[model samples]
Target chain A: MTVLARARRVREALLGGRNQTWHATEALRRGLLLGVGLVVAGVLAHNVVLALLGAPLLAASVLALSTKPSGTPKVTVLPVARTGEAGETALATVRVDPGHGAELLAIRLPDKGNPGPGPVHLLPASVAEIACGLYRRAWGEGVDLRLDHLVAGPDALIVHGPMVGREVSRVLLPPVRELPAGPVPARPAGLVGVHRSRRPGDSTDLRTIRPFQPGDRMRRIDWRVSLRSNDSMPYVRENHAESDADVVLVLDTRFDVAAEIADWSLPARGAAVRPGGSLDTAVRAAASLAASYLRQGDRVGLVDLGRPRLYVRPGAGRRQLLRLRNQLVVCARSAGWSSRPVLNAHQVSGGALVVVLSPFLDDAVVGATVQAARRGNLVLAMDVLPAELVAEPEDRWGEPVRQIITLERRVRLDALRGHGIAVLPWSSAEQGLHVLRPGARRSR
Target chain B: MGRVRGRGVPGWRLRAAVGVVGALIVLVLAVQGVTAVLIGLVGFVAVAAVALPGSPAAMLLIGVSAVATAVLPGEPLRWEVLVLIPLVHLLHLSCALAAILPRGGRLHLAALRAPVRRFAFVQAGAFGLAGLVALLPSDRADPVVEVLGLLGAAGLVLLVAALLRDRDRVG
Candidate 1:
């Protein structure tokens, strides 16, 4: 570019167009006025000491003002990962090209309940680049970052923008912990599956000995049974075939009651998942269950009772597990308090094990779980509600309110058990799975 | 672009430097008179103002100190007065550094090089002028002519500043 063109561009950048402009900050204006006033006063009063001190101030202000900052520097923030695993660190870099005359660059990132790296101030330089590191502490889609860039001129006399930049949205996947494989259905479908099927086909386990049919394999015939029969009829041994079962995870997103006593009174948005909140417990448990079932070569699907639109078809394999995890984050993100919770029968496959994860705060969730169980699906209502309750301080009738809610919740859970649907507290997941075991009868 | 971060001078370090300079100024003033010490205390208050990241109170205090020194009864000219001028300039520079830099901001030695260089030039000029003034017979120069000379110098500085301000760019 020609020198004249370069100069023109610099002027335009300093003056700014409609969208961007350079303006003096309060500090800068104060410095300029004070510097001039003191120096002039020193000269008029014939005080050499004062003039000497004031001269530098005046010189600094003039020098800062004279050096017009180079054009409005555009800040470019690199794209961050769309999905992050809990405890994983993700980096986002912001670059300012040809960063001439930028005295200070202030970069602000987003703040959720979890502490994020604070704003960084880069010393003035020709080219500045800042890399922000974010730590994913919890599950669910957290609005991780919104970049705000502010550029100050020399001596910070002139500043342009605290311009709001693009917001970074990150979906933090729930950490899947080690969970023991739960009980599988007695009657499984499909040719290749993990569970044993009652209907004999081709498997290692022996089923029953019967007279050889027309299509019976020759190898399956039991010679001892045939010799004992003495009726000249060969008996064929049948083996139970191993098959896979469908596990449909039903997430109740109506209300996320925090387990912590102190967080009960906080605003719902911030208090939605207080580390060990009911929703957090549900999401984590659901993730663990899905991973365990999928690892067993079983088809797993997901259904959010709060949002019917988000539904995952029954699928198996590693890809399905990833899809289910992503969906879980979406499910938790939209798991706000709802008045009416919906659970459709189409969401559950016949003979499928339906695990309904809910705090059971609302009677509607309890009704949905019972309805699913009654429809011939084995429903396990995982009570994610904390055992103890803490009431808000300002609530005058906190004790009475707690007592009433607790009493109602107990009755609802009893009703669910009365309908043969297994009501289990999520805290004791092993006992719940034991209850669902077909061969191993539960004592309860 | 690659990641880049520069550490400028630390705030506390610069503030401590200014505090030491203030203590020296107080000691000098105490030797002069109790009234001068009181004036030094006032200047210290202004130093407190400059310690804030963005405040102009330092300038007012500097003006007050200059007036106090000029009007005070003393030997018409002294070598100590010349030394005090640059020392006061240094204090102002330190205060400005403390004020302009962000809190906890590390001062890049590179950034300080230019300002410190300019300050050295200004100090050299001031010392040269003081030397010439000291050579003159203290009783020979008329007080009116001395004031006129100071005004002429101030005018010359204003003219230079105006010319510099009009320039399209600062080098």
Candidate 2:
């Protein structure tokens, strides 16, 4: 391409855009055609009233044409909140600058995951700002707004666009419920935390009062206890060492199923996880447990059974909670069936509470849970399967299919219990609470 | 399409409004006893305009209304023909605006102000023309009346030009 040719091409492009930006709409065509045709016909036929009526129609059309838009309007979608929780409404503001001669503006706002550009909002061009509110229906990252806009000249005679604006995406975090799990089990490792460790350390929970030996600091003496004792030795109060435990939440994204048995095999149309589906429940459950453990000063991490690349290393703090929730969206975004579940020994630390969240629909997930249990991790299998199974209305064998699924799931749960893995329903209130009890520490 | 009665859709009610305006034009033509074909075309345009405003049916509907006004045998200055001017414009305005916002978001009243203002201004001007036609002496087809008609038309054109210039000045 020569420079002259390139310049020519560029000129043609600009000219083409200018020409194509404004096209006569149906209303414009109607006005001009009828306005001209009627006035001419009425005049030649000697019918004056007809010509008079045609005058206004002609004037309006001409006015619309005369006010030809000079510049192509620029449309921008500014999402007010780039991150939101499921079931929350997110707002986005759409702005357009039609420059001049544009009368009306139409822009599509967010609809609930509706295909295409969602809904169109027709407003006058003078109203430059448009507010679109979209309700985030489900968890996971999603495109919040696909702003499609059109600018039209007065009386809607000529239109400038159907020009599509870039999609304004948002990360919809999964809703976190208060998962009341058992107490934080004592770990002997960390120097400081909320839970008791086997070794004595600085925590309010007392271990025992013992006689002060040599080299003990004078501040260690409990004078009241020392006076009560007849021995010559000064007594000191010893407290259990407060240590933090590591909690690793394993999420099974192998399959997503809802209570609706018929729709189980159907592909999710545009959703990462079906609302209230097994995978959704599992993600939410994992988030809740993570929040609980983190609040208790324990380190919490995430392991994606289907995709190990999404693994989050155990960490403790407020920042860790946000990291886990954000990572959960990424995990669910790519949730699908993989050959074998990957809950490797290295993914979980020694004595970390391993909570497996899955529907336990297939044997591979069950086998993985059993392997984690055998690897000496404290394992709890959270059954996230929705209990209220809805049968297909029209299928003749719906009841039989439901019964088979229920019985098979029941057998799986029993098998998991047989392997010494505590199987608890996700809806259970007191799950993992026993882990906090004195001497409740158990390893596979 | 007209089936877009979704709750969240903006301009959800505009389609109904456009349909009403289209229907009114059709009714006027029907009462005037114009050709059935023209009336039928107007009727189809009414339905099509609401469902697919971007389609050419709206323009065709305007043309049919104009043709109906031209050929109707009654008084040339009958109020029915005079009314079609604004009705067609309203249908056009409503249809075009409806097509802009087919579906989502809440329609703020501010958004409709400019277009509605324009619609009203154009209609008032059109009705003003109708008033002038009523005041004129008689039989519009007469050559003397033709010259006056031509002069009034020239004045109308001049007025539109002045408005256009005024818009340019404002810009």
Q: Which prediction has the highest TM-score against the true structure? A: 2
Tens digits of lDDT, candidate 1, A1-444: 999768757775775532255555544544455456555665565554445545555666666666777676688777777887988888777677524666555555432323543333434444456665677787776666766666666655566665666767777888887777776654566778867777777888898999999998999999998999979999999998888989899988766777544555565555336578787888898898999999999999999888888899989998898899999888877776456877888888887888989888777888888888878887778898888887656768776788887888899999898997777888888766765675322321
List the candidate 1 regions with Cα displacement exceeding 4 Å: A1-32, A62-68, A72-74, A77-79, A92-98, A109-114, A122-132, A143-147, A158-160, A260-265, A268-272, A392-396, A438-444, B1-171
Residue A103 in model 1: shift from native, Å?
4.6
> True interface contacts reproduced by each model, as a fraction?
0.19, 0.41
Clashes of 2: 7
TM-score of 2: 0.82
Task: Report per-candidate DockQ.
Answer: 0.22, 0.29
Worst 10 residues of 2 chain A by lDDT: A435-444
